[model samples]
Structure formats: structure tokens, C-alpha cells
Target chain A: MTTGSGGRTVPRERERPGLTPEESALVVRIGVFVKMRWLAIAGVLIASLIATQAFHIQFSLVPIYIICAVMTVYNFLFLYQARHLNVEASDSLPETLAVPLRHLLIIPRATSPLLARARATGNVHIIVDLAALTVLLHYTGGIENPFIFYFVFHVILAGILLHYRVAYLVATWAILTVLLLIGLEYYEVIPHVHLEGFAAAGLYQQGSYILSVLLALSTCLYASAYMVTSISGELRKRQREVVALQQKGLTEKTRELEEASEELTTLEEGRQHLLRFLAIASHDLKAPLSAVQSYIQLMLGGFSGELTDKQRQMLERSSIRITEQLELISDLLDISRIEGGQIVKEMEEMSLSQVVGDSVENVRAMATDKSIKLGTRMPASLPKLKASGVRLKQAITNLLVNAIKFTPENGEVLLRITEQSGDIYTEVLDTGVGIGAEDLPKIFDDFYRGSDREKAGSGLGLSIVKRVVEAHGGKIWAESPNPEDKKGRGSKFTFLLPKNLVIAGKKQGRKARLKSQET
Target chain B: MAYKILLVDDDPDIRDVVTMLLESKGYETVTACDGIECLAALRAEEPDLMIIDLLMPKMDGFAVLKELEDGRWSKYRNIPILILSSVREEASRRRYELETALEFNVDDYVEKPINPEVLLERVERLVNKNKKA
Candidate 1:
């Protein structure tokens, strides 16, 4: 049920979920048709009034007014019908509902019946409007009226809204209707109700005028239809390509995200494996090592027998060295656990002030032994953060011990805790031999000791501190020749922790930690 | 007579050193190399207290604790158990805490790379507690 790369299967559902682009475009064009009809209705109404009332041109206004009323009525009907179709086309129905309509209205493939009906209605509108315009022109000198050229506008509308063949058919229909009107009037088959002052007298009867005018009108209508249809066809093609390209980009991004997630899963498994190895290795190595150290203690305690001072001193020294190695193994395990993201399981709401206080008290003896002055600068009240108190104490203790180890006798070490914005800042500043510039960047690396390797430590102390801080979603950095120190010889190590530390993969870590504990 | 302590570990070096340390302190120690031997020694020697290691060759400490809870060893149920672990003390303590919460009995834990004084002090305390109870 899953891919090899863990990528999700492509979705089968439609993205738009509404009408196909062809159906929607037809709905919009129907709206535009109604608007253009309204403009024509107004022009007819105003032109009739201006010709008879203002210019006193002798033409009966009753028929022209009646035609305007008819145009208004049909325009309203078209507007209402277009609104109903618009709602039907744009509604996003459930798949079950749409499936029933698939053959009838919801086909995303070739033109469905709904779109065909819309195109049919478009053709009918153009035919009816051309007929009305011819009737209106008949009363106003028929072929002599220049408004007869208005048929070309209908041809243009057809080109944009209908198929190429339909647009040409519409143009032909306009030409045939106009020719019928002009021929009927010229041959005296129908009476030409001429506008008395609008054109030269008897211009409607001129054979040369009719021929040249009809020639120009036919050429103009066909030209407009051809040009408009070709341009609109190219535009629709480009629109589809853009949609396809966008879909491709989305799929690529989804694949990339899935790959990254799988990589993280593999890395997590590797870390759990390493944690297991470390646990077993620690026990196997430290068990015998500790047993050896204990035997030395037994000899030193006179349990075996009373020992010479030389043997006692040597045993004590060896005991100290084994203890250091034990501590080093512990430090290594700590780093492993931190990197494995097990710290989240140990986290609880606790105050940083308490951890800082305990760490300071823990290192007080070491400081006193070195004759190093210890100082603290922190407010009485501090914010609580979600952190592993034991790990934090370990980190703070490492910092304090590192500071004291490098600081000479009578030197000063300061523990400063400050709250800034939403973060808590803890700085350990010591008046000791400052770190070299060459070693500053690598100080946080495991087993990286500075030029001051003469000082005793596992070299993993600062790295442990770094791991602990980062695991809690915090940052730690070191500054050599502490800028704020007047002595200008000490190093400053500061770590900033947010009031709320958010561990990544916290939920997953909890599950794994519990499982490891159960084992 | 001095109190008897049962020491269970798979490692020979740990058993020898710990037994020597306990004997030096005037406490007699019975040793078992694994959990099977630990149960056998508990029944045979009836030591005053048990110091068991967690990781072993057969039937680890947790399974042994579960076995003790099965009522077959109900007569020795009052015997205190001290867990000696080389795994992190927190992890071992948490495991034993869960076992005890389920009513499986264990008394104390000592992490290895052990400090001799601390181990002896804990062993003495558990043995005395067993006597008092």
C-alpha cells in the first residue's frame, strides 16, 4: 500500500471540481450577450425619439418603439436564463451526484450537452437580434440606413463565443437576412418606409449603392469572425498549458517532501541502533573496569593486608585514573543519549535558577581548592522552562568545572543568569587563560581539547554541554578574552534557553524512550 | 553470624571483586553467574539479601522479578533485592520502579563503575533492613 520511496499516491479527485472550462466560458459569454443587448435596446429607443421629436424627420415612431420594447423583453429573459445557467455550471457537487450528470452536464472531456445547449442558445440570440435589426432598418430606408452595418458586430460576438464553423455560419446568416431585406425593398416586393431627411431621396432604389454596400458588409463580417476566432483559439491553448505546468510543479514538491521524511525515518532508526550499542558497550566495558577499581580500593583499605606508603600512593593514583576513564565513558554515553533525542523523555517543568544554584554549589569545593573567587549575578525570581533537570545540571556543572579548571589561583569565576525577552540567558565567565582563536570554532566538537589540555577533563564536557543545550532547542557559544572582563584573560561561555523549550520529534522520542526502557 | 548476601552477575571479574569486598567487610557473599543460578542460590543458601545484576545470559533480572511475583517464591518474598546495573542508573531505576509499581519487589539500585564505599553502604543497609522486617 506504500511506495518504495514512501511517496503518497497521486490523488484521483478533480482539483477544480466545478464545470469544465468550456462550459464556464459559455456561461460568461451568455452574460456578455445580455449586456450588449441592453445597450442596443437603449440605442434603438433613444434614436427613435431623436429622429422624430428632435430632428422632425418624418418616420412613424410606433413600430420603432414597439421593437425597442420587444428587444427589452428578450434581453431580460436572456439575463435571467444566463443567471440560472451560471449557478448550475459553478456548483461543486459530490462525486456521487456528479457521476449521474457525467454524460448530461459534467463531462470534462469533449463538449457536454449543457455546453452544446448554451452554444445553441447563443446562436439563437444572434439570429433573433439580427432579425430585429433588419426589421428596424426596413422602416428607416432599408438599404439606405447606415445602421445596417451593425450586423458585423453580431458576427464578431459569435467568433469569440462559438466554434469556428458556428461563427462562420452566424456571419452567413447575417448576410442572408440583410440581403433578403434589401432585395425585397429594391424589387418592390415590400414597401420601404424611408427616413425623409436621414439620406438622399430615392437612395434606397440605387442599384450601384446596394451592390457596393453589400460587398463591403459581407467582407467586414467574415473578416472580423475569422480574426477573432483564431486569436481566441491560441489563448485557450496557452491557458491549458499553464494549468498543466502548475500541476507538474505541485507533484514534484510533494515527492521532495516525501523523500525528506523517509530520510529522517532512516536516520532515526540508525540513532536507536547506536543507542543500543552504546548501552551494551558501556555496561561491558565499565563493569570490569569498575571491578578493577574496586579491587584497588580493597587493597588500599588494608582489606588484603597493610600496605607500604609507596603502594598506597600508587594505588590511589591508579584509582583516580580509572575513575577518570569511567567518567569519560559516562560522558560519551551522555552525548549519545542526547543525540538520540532521549532528553525529551526526562523533561519536566523546573526553574533554571534552581539548576544554576545546584551547579554552583556542586563546584564550590573545586573553586575553593583552587583559591578561585566565585560570584553569582541573577535575580531572585526566574522563569520556569521544560528541560531535563539532571541534564541541565550536568551541563551547568561542566561549564563551571571547565571555567574553574583553567582559572589560576585568586582568579574569579562568575555565574550570571539574565532574562531577556522570552529567553533565559546563563553566562559562565572565568578569569583564566582564554581560548585560542584557532580553537574557538571547534570547541563544541567531541574530544576537542584546547591548548589547555594540561587541565584534567574528558574533553567531552563542553561537547556534552553543547548537545544538551541544542536538544532543548537552545544555543550555546564561547567567547575568548571575555569582552566584559576587565582582566581580559578569561573566557565567557553563554547559553540561551527559551522560556518554553520545544524539542523536535518529541512525541516520537517519548514512544522510543518508553520502548527502550521496557527492554 | 554475619549477614549473607547473594551476588548475581554474568561477569567473573565483577563477582570476584564484589565478593572479596563483601568478605573484607565481614559479610558472607554467595555468587551466581546468571539469573537461573541466582534463583537456585536463593533457594539453597537463603541469603539475608539479594544483589542482582539486570543484564545476564539467561532469564534477565526483570523476568526473575516477574518469576518471584508468581507466588512460587512467596516464602522468600520478604527478602530485599538490590539491583546492580552498569546501564545508566536512571534507566535501571525507572525499570525497577515500574516493576515495583506492578507489585514485583525490588529494594534499591547501584550503578556500576561503582564506588566501593557506596556499594558496601547500600549492601549493609539492605541486609539490616531485611533483618528488621
Candidate 2:
């Protein structure tokens, strides 16, 4: 009972069934043939007794009784054979346990009835059919007899059980045998046994009559044989299809399994590449910038040669500008990394107050420098959210920074937290430069700086916020000059997140995986 | 007496700037362009303090820590180490923890684009601590 990879329980392999559908089909054919034989035996006995006693038909009773006894014995022999086989797969040994040797030795030397492992041969029963038909034909009427149709019945059964050519040949032989019997009776070489109560001896003796009758009988036999052969052919084709379906099922499952394992290997390589790229970007991109900034700081701090006020002012300007550019580059990297699937939500039962509190406080100093009132409006007790604190903090901080950047001095920037039915809506409303109608749609797009507002940013901040909100099964939008907003020059950025999260992860990705598995 | 501090960096501009920055504060300074040169200089004449950059050619800052793990610090002057690099402080700390199994740690961590006052204060405090010990 070893566990499979990924902790899946391994299914134990079971032994194949004693009889597959085809084999069971063969058993059914044999059982049906035996049943028909029983019907024939009863029919022959009743018909012979009625013909001999009531109708006084001119057939010998002793020969008919002997044939019946032979058929009965054959039926008993086949029935005895059926007793030994355990076709239901009941007697097979269990995989977990062993059968004792003494049990095998104690069994009688009789063959197991249902133990018929060999593929069923339908042609094996052909002999019994032919013998019975020949005996009935000989006893009741040889020529000028309706009992002659028994030959056609036997030939049709042959067509169903045997190959087309063999069945056709059997039908042809039966027709020729009838013609020979009729010719002999017509020429006075053998006796004609006509059906009792129907005196048709004159018809059998007429050359023209026998010729037409034989011709029509031959055609009928051929057509019946062809019909049975075609039906049998259709059945065999369907059986072959069943086998092919099983094979196709296995192939499809194998292909799906191959694809899944291949995906994991690819994921492993992707992780390694991502880590290496991050390391290189950290050292190569930031290293030189840091070095230049360090040098500029030293000069400004009087570690280098003494600088005049003008020189100091220019150097400090360069330092601040460089710091801002470095910040933009870092934000660009964050945006790219987050898009490349670095946003993993570590779910915790944290409040909306907690999610938004620290970020507003962090941006307070910048807001105060402009004399802007930065405030958060929330319910007395807000609902908790299941999300990653770090990513959520980053998103809130970006929005606040944008609000502070756009808002003029003394402009009020409000962070409104409200529950809209089931959704938790967080809006950052700023009163400053309102975005134009044309620029509203493109505001959240990456690297899109509104042609109206002059504030420079990587322009990825709002897009990242949108992505984070959507990843949490929520959405974000921005509305400038909103009707209910107090500030005329207002740009309100609102994002709604469900307070009750439906599992914190990529729902789309997992759904795609399950959909693939189903196929 | 001026305390001697070893400044190791791959960037020559940074090495010179840090060297002069320490020297201007009355500490004697020697600069090595990379970790290889840094180790060689350490073997030649030990310093009171070492300021190592995390990323360097031939041998990195982590490699220096691994090399010094073999009782080499006991043979020389007790050199309090400080890591100053462009790598995030948390990333560097995690690497050092993994490499030295937290048994050893840098005396101070100062990220790049450092404030001159903070750098000098951290350096002087480490040097003073080493002297007292």
C-alpha cells in the first residue's frame, strides 16, 4: 500500500475478468444454440407421435425414437460440460491470499464447466443442426414435401454461425440434395414420401414442375444465406469497434499524463530562470546607480573637496533626481515581476482597517508637506479580508502616492472604505487636477501618463492595483468629477474586493487544469 | 591613533569614494577592488574593520565569510565586518544565514545609496566595540 507521488492513493491492479464481453458473447451463443436444440427435441417427439398414431403417417417409429434418444444423450453431455466452468469468475484466487494445494488435489478429474478459456467456435454446433435436419427430412417427406423447408432453416443457421462462403456452400448442397431426391422419385429409382393429407406425388413426378420449383428454392436459399451473412458481418464490425474504443481510451489518458508531467518540468526550469534574472537585475541594474549616488552624497557631505553653495546645490539636485529615477526603475521591476506571477496571496484574517491603516500613515508626511488632509473613512467595525498583507500594502501605497502627487496644496485626499452589499469598496478620492474624459479609460494602463496632468510615474501603479484586485476575484475603476464627490477637481480611484474570499489563489488557472483533466 | 579599515568593492569609483570617506574621518584606509584582493590584503596585514560588497568578481562576499570560517579570524586582528551592497538587506542576510548557518553574522548592514552619517556612525561604533573587546 505505497502512496503515489503527490500523496495520491495508488489503485491496486485487479486480475482480468474470466470472460471479456466477446468471450461472454460466445458463451451466450452456445447457450442459445443448446436452448434451441431443446426446443427441437420436444418438437420432433410431439410431431412424430402425432404423425404415427393420429395421422398414420408412413414413417418408421423405431428409427425416430433412436434419433431422439441420441439427441437427448448429446444434450445431457453438453449440460454436464456446462457444470464445470466458473464463468462468473467466482472461483479465482484473491490477489492478497494464496489457494491451498490440497483444495486443487481434492477436486474430481471432471473439467470445469465455465472454465472454457478457448474462443467460442460457432461452427462446432453446425454438425448437430445438419444431422437433425437430415433425419427429419428423410422421415416426414423427401420430395414433394413442405418439411423440405427444414433444409433452408438449417442453412440459415449455418450462415449466422459460419463464414459467408461456407454457409453459401451448405445452402447450395441442401438445394442439390433435394433436386436429387426429387429426380430419383420421379424416375422410380427411390420411394417418395409425400406429406400425409396432401397427395402431391403427381407434382413431384412432372419434369416441368420440379424444374421450376427447384429453381425458385435455390434462389430463396441463396438470398436467405446472403441476408444472414450480412447481418453477422455488421455484428462483427461493432465488436471490433468496442475493442478499439478501449485502446483509444488508454492512449488519450497516456497523452494527458505526459502533458501534465511535462508542465511540472517546465515550471521547475521557469522558477530557476526567474530567480537568476532577479539576482542579475538586483546587482547589475542597481549597483552602478547606488555607486553614483554614494559618490554624490559624499561630495554633498563635505567628504570630498570643499564645495561652493552653487556647486552643492547642483549636486544635491542631481542626487534627488537620480533617487527618483532609481525608484521608477524599482517600480518597473516590481510591475514586471508581479505580472510574471510573483503575486502569491498568503491568506490571513486581517481587517480592512489593518490593510489600509499603515499605508495612509506612511504617506501622511508627504500629504502634510502639501497641507493636504489624508484621511480614511471606514465603518466602526469592518469585515476581515483574506489576502496577502505585503501585496495589498503595495497596492494601497501606490494609490496614495498617486493621490498625493496629483492633489494641490490644501487639497483633501480621502480613503473611503465602504461595504457595497457583499463587496468591500476602497476608494482613494483626491481633490486636485481632474482627469479629462478621454484620459479616464487609459489611466490604469501601464506607462500611460495623462497628457493633461504633468505628474511623472512608471504608470504601472494603477494597473498593478487592478491586477491584484482582479486576482482576488474583484475589480477596480476610476471616476473623475464624480457627481457625489465633494471636490470639483476630484479623481476617485475605487477598487472593490469581496470580504468573503472564494479561496485566495488563481481560480482561472486551477479551473483550466481541472477542465483539461476531464477531457 | 587612526584605526585601519579595509574597504572591498568591485566598483572602483565606490571603492575610492568609500576609502576617502573613511580617511576624511581620521581612519586609515586600504582599498581592494574585489573579494580576491580583499582576502590577500587581509592575509598581508589585518585591519580593524572590513566593509565588503556582496557581489564581486572571482570571489564574492559570502565566499570571504566561508574562507574566514576556518579559525583564520583567531590568527589575525578581530575584524568586525560590515556589508554594504546594492543587494537588498534582507536577501543578503538570508544568504549569510544559509552560508554560515547563523553561527556568524555581519557586524552591520548598510544598503547602497547610504546616508554618509549613518555609514560613518555604524563604522565608528563597530570600531569602538572591537577596540573595547
Candidate 3:
């Protein structure tokens, strides 16, 4: 396989199983031929009845009725044959794969088996029609009948439905049939029934009239064959071009979609690489910052030497700033890892209350440092959940730290764990300052401090918690003015973990994978 | 006599600060830059406690922990080990736990940038506990 202009590997041309455009056109024309013959049969019956009953034209009806009856029988047979071939053509082929058989006109024997059969059938029908018309014309008025021009119609049909050479051959056959009829009638070899009122008397007996009529009809038949064959040839060529253009358009669309999909895959890979870089960069960044903090702590602890109160206070402030910077880096690392989908790899089965308990204990010291009482209310026996316990604790700790940071001294912060409706809800509520109504909706947005930009922690705290909750197939929401608090001056942050946590992870992964495939 | 402690870290700044902190607390200290040097130091002379960083060049703290568990180092197995590093990632902790199939075998795990007083308290507790044993 070699890459095409589209940069997609192109396979070798396959042997498509279907009818060519020429064959399809032939099938359609054959059906039309059958339908037109039914009209011819009806015209014959109606005309003969009108001639005998209405016009009182004197002619024996026996031969005329016999020819009409024969036409009816074969027309039914042709209808069945056309239907059978039409079904075969349509059922075996997809329409898009059909293109005109360019060489079939010059080399009919090289055509498909189905096309060969259809061509043979069409040729036989034309020849049979010519023979039948000849007999009917001879019986009606020999060379005087106006319906003798019907020979031109069959020649034109042959041009439309058969190979060009075959159409010429049909024209010759029609001309010979006419000549034979006129010769027989002239030689009195066959009895020529006469239309006594319709034409001049003994018109069949005039040699000059017969020869002139024969020449006009021969020229008319040859001209019809030549013009119709050339026109149909040009039509087929144009159809071939249109079909090829359509195929080209379809291939181009497919190629564009494939290119777009490949681009999406590359973009996804790039995003993954960026996330990995972020994780590594943040980790690398945090290392030296932590070292600086350690040195500051050592000095603050009087290990380097005694320091002035002013120097001590300044060093303490620097240490706090370093700690904040380190915390920000850790948050960045957590966000990147969560976005990178590594959180799913760390899931473990543990109790919901156990995680909440650990989180509360983690933040209790901070609450005490601020003189804000931290209380937890958990059900005595809680069901277990499958989740990334570390991420869960981080989310809970962020919420607690946020509450403790915002609340005033002696303000109370409560963490309550409750099981409801197949979900484990961990709610953190504080009694100091409630979030504004405008800030509630955007609190979970990345870097959204919601009008509280002066907060001590990274603004990514709530957003990271949101990502963690969603990664576990859960939801988190914030409400101002804690409904559970009697004072109505605090905010409540609650996140619920569904009992079927692992299924959520799988579903998320599946959705992501499916979206990639679609692109 | 002051109890001797081995401090293993790749960063010289951290090693200097921690060494100063330990010495200020009246504890003698030795320093090694990586797990390989730490192992070599242990062979030369065992200390009462080992305070090591988890991430380092040449060899990491986990490899040192695994090597210390070997029967060849049985005599030093009783010496208390404290893990001190900026790498507070649960992944590393989980890896160590999964490999050992037990609780963290170290005497204590302390994340970096900790209060020096708390670090000293944990260090003294481990050393005194080993002494009592």
C-alpha cells in the first residue's frame, strides 16, 4: 500500500461486484421496451376493432387478430424477462460503483455475463418486433399502410439499447424484411390483404410506388439508427463522467474526515504530554521551594543563631509566602494529574466516613489555630465506596480549609457525612461569612475566587475538588447561607459520592474513548 | 553522649539546614548525598537513626529501604528510619506499601517544610524509643 495525496494508505483497486452504467442503462431500456410493447398490443387491438366496426373498412380480421394475439403472448414473456434481469442488476450492485463500460460498445463479448445476457435478450426482442410488424403490415395494406413507419421506431430502440454495430445490423434486418414482403406481394407469392377504402385500389400492384416507398423507409430506418446511436453514445459518456465526479467527491469527503480525525488524535496526545510536563514541572518547582522553606524554618527555630524580633517576624512572613507558593505548586500538580486521568489508577475500596474522618482530623489543627471549632457528624456505620481516597481527602480538606480560613475566630465549622438516596454526602459548613449569591455559581470554575480574591489559598482549590468529584462520577455544589445553621450567615459546600463509583469511572473513560473515535 | 543520626538528601541546602537543626538539638549528625552513599556510610558506622529523603540521585529512598530489609543488614534493621522529603505523593507511599505488604516500615514519615520543632520531636522520640528497646 502507498500513501495517496491525502496521506492515507491506498489499497489496490478491488474487483467491484456490480453492474456497469451501460448495463444499468440497458436494463432500464429493456423495461421500457416491454412497457411500450404493451401499448403496441393495445393499439393494434383498438385500431383493428375501429377499422372493422366504425369505419366499415373491408378487410379479413382473422390474420390481424392472430398477429395481435401473438404480440400479447410475447409481451407478457418479455415483461417477466425484464423484471428478472432488473432484480438481478439492482440486487447484485451498489449504485455508486457503477460506471459506464467504455469498451463494451466496441467489444460486446468482453462484457459481464449479466450484460451479455441482457444484450442478447434486447437484440432478440427488437428482431422479433420487426418480424411481427412486417407480417401485420403485409396483411393490412402491403406497401400502402402508414403504420409501416413503425419500423423506424424499432430501429431507434435498437440503437438506444444495443451496441452501435448491432443497431446497424437490426436496421438491415428491418429493411430486408420490408423488401421481402414487398417482393412477395409483387410476385403474388403471398396473398396481400387490401384496405379497400384506406388506400388507392391495387396500390400493392404498382412497381414504381412500391420501389419509392421502399427507398424512403430504408433511408428513414438507417438515419434513425445512426442519429439515435450517436446521441445515446454521447449520453453514456456524459453519465460516465458525472458518475466519476461523484465518486471523486465521495472519496475526498472521506479523506477530509480521516484527516480531521487524525488531527484530533494528535491534539489529544499533545494535551497528554502537556499535562505530564505540568506535573513534572510543578513537582520540580516545589522541591527547591520546600528546601527554602526548610531553611527558613531552621533559622526561625533558632538553629542558625538568635534573631531580633523584627528579623524573626520578617523571616516568618517569608516562610508563610514560601509555604503558599509550595501549596500552589501542589495544587497545580494535582490539577494536572486529575486532568491527565491518572486519578482513576489510584482508586481503592474504603469507607466514606473513614475518608471524611481523616479529612476532618487533617484540618482540625488549622481550625484550632484560628480558634474556630471544627466538628464532624458522621453516621455510626457507613457503607464502603470505591474511590481515590487521597483525592477525596484533598477535596474535603480544601473545603474545610476554605471554611476555616473564611470564618471568624470562635466561629464554628462543621463537617457532616450523611447517606442519602444511594449517595454519600459530605457537607462542610461554616458560621462566619456566607458566599454572595452571585459568587455561588462560579465558585467551582477554575481560578474563580468569586469576589474573594484575597483568600490565602490557590483559587484552584474548588475547581480541583470539582474535577476530583466528577472524575469519581459524582457532583459537588455550594449554597450560601447554610440552611442547617440557625444563624443563616455561613456557606455550605456539599459533595455526594454515588454508591456505584467504579462504574462512573468506566463510563467516563468509555465516553472519552468514544469521542476520540468519533473525531 | 549525643545520639548520632545519618541525614541522606541530594540537595545540599536541605542537608545543611537539617544538619544544623539536628546539631542545634544536641544530636551528632553525618550526611550522605544519596542512597548509595548512605549505604556506604551505614557499613562504615551505624547510627542511632536514619533521616532520608525519598527522591535522590543514583539511588532512591525506596531502594535503600529494600536493601536494609535484606538479611545481610540484619544488625542495622533495629536502627530507626525516618522518611523526610518534599514528595508527599500517595503513589510513592502506595508503591512502598505494596512492595513491602505491610504498614510503612519506617519509624515515621514526615513531609518537608515541616516545623523544625516537630521534626526534632519525632526524631528524638524515635531515637529514645530505639534506645529503650
Candidate 4:
């Protein structure tokens, strides 16, 4: 699989899965070890030459020069081998693939059985580096040489890259090696290589100087290792906490999405159940109401037999009541049909003035019965509107009939239609016992009747009108104390329909225009 | 000429009431329980007008219209069809027109709980209009 700059590419399963943690870490260690070896080779070569040729201060130069040359060549070879193993690490089964024998053939000095043991304890390579360093320090005056600073570098490297215990072991080992070197040179166990061509300083002969140099070198190495390990430990703990917080945030978002969809599904099911209940109940009521009215009308028409005036009067009243009940049921059905969101109304271009005139005529008799004045206020040349004419007429008729029911004798009811910014506004205003502030809020609600309502009737009319107005893509509302009234009297109901409702699904040159002559 | 009406509805009460109402106006009515029976009755006695209901068993009003359009009963093509039911007329009418690739092929729409005066006026007008045409 190809890894991008983003890292950790999604692998092609059939091609191969990615590497495991153990293999990846081991390969990275091999790469870092190769890099460290190159640094060591360069540092040794530079230090050796500065003392031998530049400073002319070296006693034994041939053996150190040969070791430096061999180290440079060996480090270059190890770099090539490291890259080869890394490629193998990526291509192999990614876990438990044994390190090749060549991996053990490290260090320019000698091949020891410690190759496998070095990888096991993981700090054995650092031990080998320390061995090489001990030899360099031996020729350079052991503890007296400023080159002893190299021990401090190895200690810091171990602290950052290896376990703390391993780093402490390596630091302690460096400190012990210095003391042993000073002891050997001072006791003449190994002959001291004092500067011959260079000026000989008694700094090496003074036992106090040797003792103090050893003390400072050992302290510096152990102190640096301790500080680096503690700092790195704190950084790692913070990184783990950040990762856990990100995972928690992801899980919370997923749960919220699940809950939102569940709520939507439950809401949809509840609406459907309610619509079914309304339709079945309405149809059942309609059937019997139809039968009762039919039988009653037939008897009143003298089909069964002649009736006395008293019996006829009673039958007529019952028939009228049944008719009113049937009308209420019809209005309730209309509201549910629209509220159920199951209806598709057929809209057409029709005259607003004509509709208003026709609806007002239907209510003229009611107004006459109450001696209430009914009228219209509209332009004679008004623009025609595109809407379902039958439903709009029903809305107007309901408003007018409501106004007449609440109005006292000789009160005024008016129908007005006008054009505003981009909508057609139809308003119905009535002057009578004005609506109380307490009743205004629930006036349009279904089955609602104000305590001050002049008469009792099915409260479904205004609710049906509200649904019809909304279904036509319009806004409807009512206000008390008609804005035109000076005395804060009368109620005004108005609704506005937009000039252009999208022609429902215009396909293949189709415009929904019911022919005017269909009437 | 006397104009006869064929009253088709699954509801027996609606059928009986409509027949009585129409007969009271001195027009004869032949009754049927469903669309299939209505089509058969139309063959036995060719009515001047047909009052059809949309929802019924054994066949519905639209199926009857389809069979009539297909000319299985070709002779009754000129008879006027009046839709008399509680179903929302405009929605069904548009559906029928779209499905048949024809315009709403009926004379008038009368929603049930109907105003009887309006039904009678439309019936008389349709019969007279057909005669004049």
C-alpha cells in the first residue's frame, strides 16, 4: 500500500494489511541506530585528527587513525543494510518476522554472540558504543580530556530513546568507566600516554584534579538523563488524554444523529394514526346523517302520508338540526383532510371579485334575517387570482356566517379585497359585540368557543378556514377592534395569498387550468 | 322525449332515496348496486342520464368510464355522466383525466350532502343541453 503525506493510508485488503506496532517500532529503531553510528564515526575522526595533525599532541596516532577509517566505512555499510531491512520490514508479514543475520553483523569492531542479546535487552548497542568511547578517551588522557563530554551525549540519547532503567544503567556504566580509567593510569596498570610533543601539564599528575574531573563528568551524565526522562513522561500522558477526548466527541455526535431520526419516525407514525381515525369516523357519521335527512325530507314532502301542521313543524326543525350537524361534520372532515397532508388541490385562475360577490350573496339572507347590513369594498377592475375557487369561497362563507351569528341587529359586515406589495389580501370585518382579549388567542383553535360567543355552533368552521388558507400557501390571522374602528370595537379576519404559487408539477406543456365553462 | 336516469351506488339507501327523488320529478330511474350492474342496466334500458358514485365493490366509476371509453358498451357514449359522491371531485377528476389522457369526461360534479336544488338544475340543464347539441 502507498502511504501519503497524511500517513497511515487505508490499505487494499487483497494487496496487504498494514504493519503492526512491534515491527514498525523495531524498524524505526534500526534507522535511528544507523544515524547515530554515522555521527559517532564523524566525531571520532574529527577529534582524532585535531589531536594528531592539527595540535600535534598525540603519542599513538596510527592505531586511532586506522580505527577511524574503518569506522567510517563500516557506518556507511550499516546505513545501506538498515535501509534494506526497513524495506523488508514493510513487505514482510509485519509481525514476528525474525531479524536477518546481517542485523547482528553490526559495529565495525567485532562480531559477538551479543547480536541477538543486544536486541533483547535493547541497551547492549549503547554498551558497544560506550566501549568504543572508552578506547578514544584512553588515548586522549582518560578523565583529564575535555572529550569526556561524549559520555553526557550518550546518556541523553539513552534517556530519550530507551527505558529509564536502561538509561540509568548506561549512565552509571559511563561514570564507573571513567573512574576505572583514572585508577588504571594513576596506578600504572596501563601506562599513561602523556603528551610528548605538546607541552606536558601537571594537571594529569595532580590527584585532586583527576578526582574532581571524574566527579563532574559522572554528575553531568546522570543529571541530564534524569531530567529528560521525566519531561518526556509528562508529554506522553497529555497526548493520551487528547486522543480520548476526540473519540468521545465523535461518539456523542453519532448518538445525537440516531436520536433525531428516531424522533422523526415516531412523529410521522403518530400523524398517520390520527388521520386514519378521523377519516373512518367522519365517513361513518356521514353515512347515517345522509340516511336520516333523506327519510325526514321524504316524509315532509307527503310521500309517506299527509301530516298535521304540528307534526310537520317538529319534523322540519329536526331536519334543519340534522342538516346543521351534517355541515359541521363536513367542516371537520375538511380540516382533517388538509391537516393530514394527503390532499392535492386543483388550482385555477379565477376572478376574486366574482367569488366575493357570490359568497356575499349566500350570506345575504342571514344578514337580512338579523337586519344586519352586508356589503363589499373592492375595485371594480381587480386582478384575477390563481387558487382553488371552491375552497376559497368556503372560507369566505364561513367568515361571513360567523360575523352574522355574532352580530346584533343592524350591525355591519364587509368583505374587502385589495392588492399589496406582492400579495392579494382578503379581509372580513364585522361590527358587533367585540371579542374579549381572553378569547382572541383560542378563537381559531378547533372545537373552541369563547365564553362570550352569542350563539353555540360547531367551532370547526374557523379552523377549517385556517387550514384552507395555509394549504393555498397563504397566511391568515384575526384581530379585534378593526383597525378602521375608532372605538376599539368589532373583529377583523384577514388572509393573504401570494401572487404566484408554483404551478404544481408543470410537465409536458401542462398548466392546471380548469376550463371556466366546466361550471 | 322522456329522459330516464340510471342511479348507480353501492349504498342501498342513497340509491333508494335518489330514485324516489328523481321519480317525484316525473323522470324514470333504473337502479344498480355497482358499476358492473350499472353497465348491464344501461344496455337493458338506455338512460338519458347516468348518476355514478366513485367508490363501490365489483367495479368503480373510473373503471366503468374506462370500459365505456374502450367501447365494450359503445352505444351509450352520448349519455351524460353526473358524478354524485362524497369524494373530493376535483382531485379525482384530474386523476381520471391524466390516467385516461382525456379531459374530465363528465357533465357536473355534485359533492354529497348535496343541495338537491343544485343537482336538479344541473340534471335538467345537462339533458336539455345534450338534446340541443
- The two-chain DockQ for each candidate, comma-separated, is 0.47, 0.49, 0.53, 0.24
Q: Which sections of candidate 2 miss by over 4 Å? A: A1-31, A52-120, A135-146, A175-220, A230-279, A304-306, A344-352, A380-384, A436-439, A451-456, A481-489, A499-519, B1-111, B118-133
lDDT tens per residue, model 4, A211-258: 788778878878977886676446435655765687799899999999
Model 1: CAPRI class:
acceptable
Residue B105 in candidate 2, Cα distance off native in Å? 11
Model 3, range A1-519, lDDT digits (tens) per residue? 000111111231211237666666666667667767877877887888898799887788888889888988988887887667644554233112122332434544634656766766776687678888988887788788878877888777767766777678777888888888988988889988888778888788898888888889889989988998898778868977887898899999999999999999998798779866874686579778888898888888888889999999999999989988888888888888888887887888755666787898988888889999898886555666678989999899999989998899999999988769768788998997889988888889877877776777778899999999999999999898988889788999999888786333322222445555665
Return the clash pairs for model 1, or none.
none
**Residues B77-120, candidate 1, lDDT per residue (tens digit)?**
89999988777555665556665666435688787755678888
lDDT of 3 by residue, B27-118 (tens): 99999999999999998878999999887878989889988888999989999999997777466688788877755578888888767988
> Higher-DockQ candidate among 1 and 2?
2
By DockQ, the best candidate is: 3
Enumerate the chain B TM-scores of all models.
Answer: 0.90, 0.91, 0.93, 0.91
lDDT by residue (A191-308, candidate 1, tens digit) is 9888888777778788899899999999988997888778776766775677678779999999999999999999989988987888788777787787788788778767688899
Candidate 3's error at A263, in angstroms? 2.9
TM-score of each: 0.64, 0.66, 0.59, 0.62
Interface RMSD of predicted model 4: 2.7
- Where does candidate 3 clash, by residue pair? none
Docking class of 3: medium
Per-residue error for A20 in candidate 4, Å, reads: 15
**Runs in model 3 lying further than 4 Å from the true structure:** A1-249, A300-314, A333-351, A369-372, A379-389, A408-411, A419-424, A433-455, A466-477, A496-519, B1-10, B18-85, B91-110, B114-133
